[model samples]
Each structure stands twice: as C-alpha cells, then as structure tokens.
Target: MAGKLQVGLLFGGKSVEHEISLRSARNVYQHLDRSYFNPVLIGITKKGNWHLLEDIDQSIDSAPPLNLSLGHSRHTFPTVDQQGGTGLLDVIFPVLHGTDGEDGSIQGMLQSVNIPFAGSGVLGSSVAMDKLISKQLLKDAGIPTSKFIDLTGQDISKVSYEQIENILGLPFMVKPISLGSSVGISKVSSEQEYLKAIEESLQYDQGLLAEQYISGRELECAILGNTVPRASDPGEIIVSSKYEFYTYDAKYKDPHAVEIKVPAVLDHLIVEQIKDLSLRAYKVLRCEDFARVDLFLKDNQTIYINEINTIPGFTNSSMFPSLWAQHGISYSELITKILHLATERFESKKQLTRDYSGN
Candidate 1:
C-alpha cells in the first residue's frame, strides 16, 4: 500500500438508479486490486448529502443514512479521505448511473476540481444521457437507429396516436429521454396504451422518446480505452416470455428474468460488423475510458444502434464486465485497466496548456 494510488469510489445519488449505483460501487470495490488501489468509499444520500464510509462493501440498505448538513455552498466539491484526512484520492472511479450521476452533473463537478474520473466527460456524458441528442448524433454519423420522435415539454400534449401508428406503427416504445435501467419505459400495443405510456414516461422526464419497435435481439458491446477504443465480444439479452422487454424489475430484482449470451451466435461477418459499429458509435459520442453500446440485431441480419451507457453497471449480472470476461479479461483486470485509463487521461490533460498569452 506504500505506492498504491488512492482511488475514491463514489456511489449513490438522488437519481432513481441510486440503489443500482450502490450495487455497482460494491462490485467494483470488491474486485479492485487492493495491491495497486487504496479504495475509499464516498456515499451520496438520496437527499443529496455527502458522507464518507469506513466500509466499502457494506450494504446500502442496512447502513444508516447520512444526514450531514454540508451547508448551501453549491460550488464546493466533496473531499475524499481514507485515513483521517491524512490521504487524498489520486483518481475517482464513479460507479454512479442516471440523472445527477451519469448526466454530466457529477462529471462537471469533478472537472471543475481538476480531478480525473473514469468514463465520458461533461459534454459526452450529457449528450449520451439524453436519448434524443444521442440518437441525433448517431444519425448524423450515419449510424442506423430506429425511427423516433422527441416529445418535449408541452409537445407531449400534441402527440397524435394515429400519426404515431402511421409512422412508427403499433407496439412502439415510449422512453423517458434521459434515464437508464429502463426506469421509465413502456411498450404500447394499442391506442389506449399509447396515451397511458406517454403519461407514465413523462413523469420521469420532460423529454420523451417514442421509438419504432424493433422486434429483434437485444445486443450489447463493451468498449474500453481512451484514444483508440476497442470493443469486446457482443452479448445478447434473451428475455423471458413473461416480459415484453427488459424492464427495471427484470434487470435488477428478478433472478430468472433474462439470460445473457456472450459473443452472441452470429456469422463471422456480422460479428465483425457489430464490433466495428460499436467502436464507431463510441467515438461518435466522444466517450472515454469505458462504455456499453446497446444495439438491436434484426432477424433479417440488419443491425441498429440503440444507445450508449457511459457508466455501465458493474453489478454481478451486469453485461459490460461479462462481455469483456468472455474476451478473456477478468473482472479485477477490467477494473484495474479502467483506473489506469483514468490516470492516463488525467496526465494527458495536465500536459495541455490551459492559459495562453498571444505571442
């Protein structure tokens, strides 16, 4: 532990995915190579309070809630301490997802403090978090994605069920534009369900996405690196008959909800195409360190890009690590690699000139 880099593992937030973030942070803490990383736990409460934890692997449900009244100084960043203020974190591995955590808010805070964290920067994180923006960027990049329409603010009131059915057809998907883990998603098969789905989805976000249903396989690819990212073997999500799609409950609560197939069975050419598309999507989104790109593989062999998760889950059943595991990279090694990438990116940024005087 003499020369080990101090890493602050930040988790929990005001987002609906707060519990998921806790689970992810625990998995990362458990798998982190202690020999090279002196991990510190920094937990944020649902009420937005920040507190340092002594035990990184402690269950969030059992732990007492943090009630620190850190004042109303919104500009201040939280400090990480491992040994009674005797140490400071060299880098941060934010295992946080959704809203305040994944939507560039936390990333912006980290950047203002000049601290390096894993995953995308503010611009990329914000863009990726918004489904509408991400889809537009992918479309501009010539990536094939499902046809969709964005409903913003009062626009939700102007949506016509008949027009939607005419363009995207029935059984379309209604999603809250900036959420993950399928927190606010609905599949509408009829006109009655269409209105209800939109109403339910708008509760989570003002921006809603009504996308054409792609009746195909759910495939995902994990990408890693800074400059030239590499994609892992693609994985497929086999949903149970009971569920129409991968819902929040099916993802975290239910054990037998879905089965994952790593390196999804496909022709060699299709596999190559998926990997290439995954990397291209990552670059297009300006993602860094790591991300999970979800796509749809149609029965006719055509592939469509879905969306990218800058901070993909690290839960035991998460697909990002599983995909890399299929490619011979162990969970511990993957965590180490991400940490190294954070440091490398930080050092590279430090080398750039921040202030310039015209010569």
Candidate 2:
C-alpha cells in the first residue's frame, strides 16, 4: 500500500455513449490489479460534472466532488475516500467513450494540466475522432480507406442525392463526423432514406459524411504500446441479417445482434496483410498507447479502412481485450501494461525541455 500507484478510472461523460462508458468502467474496475494500483472510481454526469464515487456502481448524487490540478489530480478524502486517504492520481485510465471523452476535449484538458493518462494524446484523439478528417488524411497518406464525400454543414445542402449516388454508388453510408458506438449512422439506398439519413445524422453532429458502402466482412485490430506500437490479432464482426449494418442498437441496445470473432479466421498471408494495414493506419492517424482500428475486407481480398476508435470500449467482451486475450494476455495484464505505457510516455515527456532561455 505504501508504494502502490493511485490510478483514477474516469468514466461516464456528457456523451450519448455514457451508458457504454459505465459498463466499461465497471469491467475495468473489476479487472484492475489491486495489489499494485489503488483504483479510484470517478463518474461524470450528463450535465458535465465529476463525482468521486465510493462504490463503482454509484448513481449520480451529491458525492464528494473531484478537482484536477497541475501534474496530479486532487480530491477530498473525508467523503470521497471513506477508507481515509489523501494522495494524487499517479495516472488516469479514462474509461470514457465517444464525444467529450474520446474526441480530444478530455485529452486536451488532461494534457494541459500535465496529467498523465492512458490512450492517445490530444492530436491523435482529435484526428481519429473526426470521420471526414481522418478519411481525408488516410487518402492523403495512401491508406486504403473507403471513398467518402464531405457532407458537413452547407456542403450537405450543396451536394445533391444524384451526385452522392454517382460518387458513392447505390448503397452508401451516412454517418456523423464525430461519434462512435455506431451512433447516428445509416445505410441509404433510396433518395427518401438518404434524405432522412441526413437529418438523423445531423441530430448528433453538425457535420456529416457519405461513404461508399462495400459488401464485405468487417474486421477490427486492437493496438497497444507507445514508442513502437503493436497490433493485436485481427478480429471480425458478423452483423446479423436483422440489421442492415452495425448500428448503435446492434452495438449496445441488443448484444446478440452481432457476433464478434477474435483472431478472425484468415489465411497467414491475409492475417499479415491485415496487421500491416492496421499498423499503417494507426501510425498515420498518430494514435498513441492503445486504439482499435476497424476495416472492411471485400470478397476480392481488398481491405478498406472504416474508422478508428481512439478510446475503444473496454468491457469484458470488448474486441480490444478479447483480441489481446486471444494472444494469451489476460484482461488485468492488459490494463497493467497500458498503465505502464502511460507512465513511460509521461516520464519521457517530462525530460524534454519545455522552456527556452537565451544562452
């Protein structure tokens, strides 16, 4: 207890994926190695408030408030820690997903305060969070992402359905620019569905993207490490015929709607290819520590990048953990490894000269 690092598990955010965050936090809290790390559960309300929770599954109430400062995070101990404690968070594993949690806002805040946290930094988080921006970068980098058209803001009104259909083809995907968990996404074939899809997507974000839909198998690759990142065994997702695509409902609302196959069955060559492309995409996107890259493999064996999840789900059954587990790494080991990566990154940054003096 004297030498253990206090790890903050931040979860629940002002994002639509709040519930998913809660689920992820619970699993992380359960798997956290108590011998080496002191787990501090922190929850955020929908209205954007942080509460230090005594219990992992505590509801939003008048819990002891938590505040963050330079270098370390500080919180009250009288009520927040009934175990009687006073210490700074050595590192934070933000178990939050989507919007404010994954889209660089929280990352930027943490970085500004000099707080060491897990997952990608501000740039990587922001770059990967925006669908259109990330696709454009991928195209520039010659990464194999699917064809997409920017329908953001007035651009959506400027592009006609006929133009979009001509470019993206009959069955296209309309998606929000800054969201995960498959929220505000739709596959459009008809003009009516396309029009309605625009409105539906705009509900979650002001920007939108129309991408070419490939009739193919979906694959995911989990990434870990800092200086030199590594891609986990490729995983596959089998969407039920009941759903046109992997929708938010299919992702969370109904668990059985999709089958997840870790270390997806593939030829040695194909598996190597998936690993290569996944690593390339992860590097091009500037992702750090850990992330999950989604890709589509067409029947012809062509692979196209779908999107990247900077702060991917961490539930027991999530692909990130499952993929690593398939490689013989347990869930607790993965968590410990990620914390080590964060501390390593922080220490490296601390040695860099932050100020300049005339010599």
User: lDDT per prediction?
Assistant: 0.86, 0.87
Model 1: how far residue 41 lies from native, Å:
0.3
Count clashing residue pairs in model 2: 0
Model 2 segments more than 4 A misplaced: 69-87
Clashing residue pairs in candidate 2 are none
Index of the highest-TM-score prediction: 2
TM-score of every candidate: 0.93, 0.94
Instruction: Return the clash pairs for model 1, or none.
Output: none
Write one digit per residue (lDDT tens) for candidate 1, span 146-259: 999887777766778888889898779999999999987999989889878878887888889899999999999999997888998799999998998999888988999999
lDDT of 2 by residue, 274-314 (tens): 88888988999999999999999999999998989988888
